[model samples]
Target: MVAVGEILLNALFQVLFDRLASPDLFSFVRQLGGGVDSELKKWEKKLRMIQAVLRDAEEKQLTDEAVKMWLDDL
Candidate 1:
């Protein structure tokens, strides 16, 4: 009984390790821009837009409450 349990446990670990090391798993992650360079490029455009909005708000001082609220909603 103990030997059978040990065999099952070893088989379970082997299967788990095989799945974790599979290329398909890595390919799926890469498709979602898991790479550092790809992830940064993905957010670059949004970051630029945010920076521009902040600069504009600072320069204009946003005296209008309605406009300020609209920007805040964003």
Candidate 2:
């Protein structure tokens, strides 16, 4: 299945290309897509890190607030 963000980005690219004749617009879209993908990857990594930290904390009998604070520190 295609991701929603990818679909939206494709639509945006098509619209931009259709309305604008400048080659710079294509470059801008490519850069925007790269930045969006980069941020998504970072978020997924952070989420996994947080989940691992929470699991370790559960094993050690740490409180929920402590787990949250640890994630916040990250």
**Residue-wise lDDT of candidate 1 within 6-63, one digit each (tens)?**
3464465556556545678657767777484465445555555655665465445457
Model 2: residues with Cα > 4 Å off, grouped in runs: 1-34, 62-74
> Whole-model lDDT, candidate 1?
0.54
TM-score of each: 0.39, 0.40
**Best candidate according to lDDT:** 1
Put down candidate 2 lDDT per residue, 1-74, tens digits, no spaces.
33354446446545644544456654665678847545555655665565555446544434466654544443
Which has the greatest TM-score?
2
Worst 10 residues of 2 by lDDT: 1-10
In model 1, which regions exceed 4 Å deviation?
33-74
